[model samples]
Target chain A: MTSPVVEVSHLRKTYPAAKRGGTPKTAVADVSFQVARGEIFGILGPNGAGKTTTVECLAGLRRSDGGTVRVLGQDPQADPLLIREHVGVQLQEAALHDKITVAEALDVFGSFYSERADPAELLDLLDLTAHRHQQFGKLSGGQKQRLSIALALVGKPQVAILDELTTGLDPAARRATWELVERVRDSGVTVLLVTHFMDEAERLCDRLVVIDGGRVVAEGTPSALIEGLEGDRGVRLRFADDGARERATQLLAALAERDADVTAAVPIGDEIEVTGTRKVLFAVVQELAAADVVPDDVRTLERTLEDVFVQVTGREYRVEENEEVAA
Target chain B: MTAVETTGPVRVNHEGLRFRAFWTLFGTELRVWLREPTGVFFALIFPSLLLLGLGLAVPDFSKPMADAPPPWNEAPGITSYLPTIIALAVGTISLTTMPVQFATFREKGILKRLSTTPMPPQNLIGVHMVINVLALIVSAGAAVVGGMVVLGVPFAADPLVVLLVLVLSTTAMFSLGLLVAARAEKGQTASGLGMLIYFPSLMFSGVWVPLSVMPDWMQEIGLYLPLGAAAQGLTMGWFGNEGFPLAQVLVLAVWTLVLFPLGVKLFRWT
Candidate 1:
């Protein structure tokens, strides 16, 4: 494959102390990832997880204390003008003048680029044509988000960095924004998505890096990350009584001893929980059928990206922390 | 990408691109400024309106001063107030309009957003300066022309000298205003700080009490401040035959020299 469109390796950034004699804070410790062309690459992390810092470095808005970042084979800090011309950034909490109309905002930003996308086409794609004349301050939250996306693509940028693009949108609006993002990617623009939403990452990212405490804890496609969890799948079976449960436990123990897929079989209350590989469910049922032992009810647990995130970060995802740490 | 292929036809003229971006932002900002009634009224029309109001309201406002030097004594009293009004025009735009606009842009993250583009946020500051300076010129011109037609005020003895003084005065006042804008966190704070400095500037420029009537010690101090020096320099250029107002011009030059670079150094993009 050709070199990735965006390359970042061992990236580190530290914010100076806000006051004299205060200790400096490290926002990004060691983040390394490469985004291939035409892929929706995601930087997934909880609040204060350095996702914003990573993209800010990639956009040349912030200087990393260590490591290196190259967008379209140009160093962001060294060739910031060229990088800015080619990389469209949708920064979180960044807004246009309140009085600027939607179309005016797009036009002004488009004027900054040598090659511009058709504003009418972009507005249609983002479903913002009806609100083209609305002032920025008057637009609804979803409309504002969509306009931001439109501005990001108005330059016909080769790489677009969208930071928390759908953070405040409702479910329907978020879905629409996601579709617009997909369309942008399909139009030959490589997208670097920074988000704390696991579902967004799972649904949109071709590959993502899970960042925690300023470091990449896990990196893979959403399904691969979920599968990377060791013995994460399981089967739960409830029995009529403890007598049947005990018999089932013995049979499952025997199964576990013989089969490599059965990692564990533990009894909780009247239900015996079997934890193992994806095929463990079928293997456990076969073992029970051989003994003519039946389960009252059975359910299989499927791991999701959320579970993978929790497993990798060793903490629940908290979105309310307000990631203003970089400021 | 398609952009790369299209780039072949579009020659890499970096300077030309930057100039185009500048004019685009400049036009947009000028429109935004004009749309706001308060900004346009205060910056563009208030000085002339104040002149017209004072000319009509105050009795014997057009009479020649009884105790003034030479040709200036022969000129109408309203003409003596012209310098102060010109200073007021530059002061209002610089302190009240420019600083608040800049601080609010920073507060609202407009500057930060612009910084992500090829054109830096400093371009916006430069645009603000150009627009505000133009407002100052228009306001000063309106006041002078209005004074001539309504209050029988005479034109400056040397229009060139008056323009030179206005330029120096504008530079000094704008530098001071930019210093306030450099670090203010909010529009409210900037306006508050602006007013704090603005009232004192008007006082020193003798807006209420003519500098000629002030005690020698008071006038000495007033000559040192930017607007005060501006008022004195403008007065000298308008009516004085005692040669150029080198001392007042030097005072304004010092103010610009000290404050402009300091403001530029202290300014923050985000």
Candidate 2:
């Protein structure tokens, strides 16, 4: 890839003690990632997983305790102003003035940069044209989110950092935001998305890093990560009769004993479940055909990103909420 | 999907962009402040209204003072309170309007949000200061005009001295208010702290009792505080032929020099 647009190495950040003599809290332990130009790169983690801190370091809003961050070929710590000029950010809890109208917010923010996107075009793209004159306080949650997104894009930034962009949005709105992000990427801006939603990452991110406890657990495309969990795929088989079920079980057990690809064959009530690698279905059907014993039906279990997370982290994926204190 | 063409990044002159951002932000913030009628009323109109009301309604208000000195004896009773009302106007905006707005913006993350952009969030403080100072001038002007037109009060004997004192006193009061706005985490706390300072300063400014009638010790202490110094200096320049109250001017100058840098140091942008 042509030189990466963003690069971070061993980023570590710790918030100072809230009170005197109190122990400092570590927000980011060690994180490293890169985003190429024109790609949707995701930083996926649970609440308080240092996702915000990592992105804040990239935006030059926060300085890292230890490590290096380079955006658009400049060190963020040394040249924060230049970094801010080129990168657009939509912070999670940041809000506009209550009395500021949609158009006014866009207009004021747009004026901050030298090259800016057309405010009218941005408003139309985010579906906020009808509410352009509406006060920020009067808009619904989704509308506010869309307006924030519009503001982020108003500067025609080369990179956009969106934190929890669709957290409070409805299903339809969430889908719409995903499409908007994709469109933004297609138009040539790199996007760095921070989210805990597996589906959102799977749908939008061309590549992503799964961070837990301030460490990267996995990094790859959604499908590639899921495909990494080999030997977990299985097939459930039903038979025409009890005799056929017994024969199939014995045959699958023999195959499991001899074939390296077959992990186990277990019987569930009147059916048999054959567990093995991705080719388990073909292996089982071949074994059954050789014996001339056919099953009534067959079903394959599908592996999703959720299962991938559980396997990789060795813990159930549960959204630990309210842990972040807005650092 | 409709194709939204992306524009290429262009190199911008930082100084030029910051200059533009400051002016744009000033205009936008001023509009937001104006939309809140309570702030505008207290800062701009209330001072003159209070002056007119007291001048017309109080018994023997416009009648010449029956005190001991020539210039003092010639002026009306209401004229003695003119400086106090002007000081109160500055206090209203400095303590109540400005701090509350700053704290509310911090609480709402408006300042924090601005930090992410190329525009420095400190510009908000400068913008607010300009707006509040302008309001101060307008209110001070109205009170002086209203006093002369409706109450038959005489104009300041030393116009240049009055102007200088107004500048010093406004800066002093605003600096004090800036100290309160610096670290207040909540709007309620800011207003509370502002009021705590506000009422006592009003007392020292002789809002409740004319400084001439206040006890010697009280008057001594009043001259040291910003509003009190402002009131005493303004009164001397307005009715008296004295060049200026050097002591009161020194006091205000000291307050401004000390409080402004301290406020900026303690400021919490987030």
Highest-DockQ candidate: 1
TM-score of each: 0.89, 0.89
Residue A276's lDDT in candidate 2 = 90
- Alpha-carbon lDDT, every model: 0.86, 0.87
Task: Give me the displacement of residue B50 in model 1, in angstroms.
Answer: 1.7
Can you give the lDDT of residue A170 in candidate 2?
A: 92
True contact recovery of candidate 2: 0.55
Q: How would you encode candidate 1's per-residue C-alpha lDDT over B173-200 as one tens digit per residue? A: 8999999999998999999999999998
TM-score, candidate number 1: 0.89
Once superposed on the true structure, which residue ranges of model 2 sit more than 4 Å away at CA?
A234-302, B1-11, B14-16, B68-75, B241-243
Q: For residues A1-327, could you state the per-residue lDDT of candidate 2 as single tens digits?
A: 366788999999988988999988888899999888899999997888889989988888888899998787777787677767778888786478888899989989988888789988898889999999998989988899989888888888889999999998899989999999999999888999999999999999999999888878889998999888845688999999999998888999999999988999999888788999878899999989998998999999777777878888788888793378455
| DockQ of all predictions against the true structure, Cα-based | 0.36, 0.34
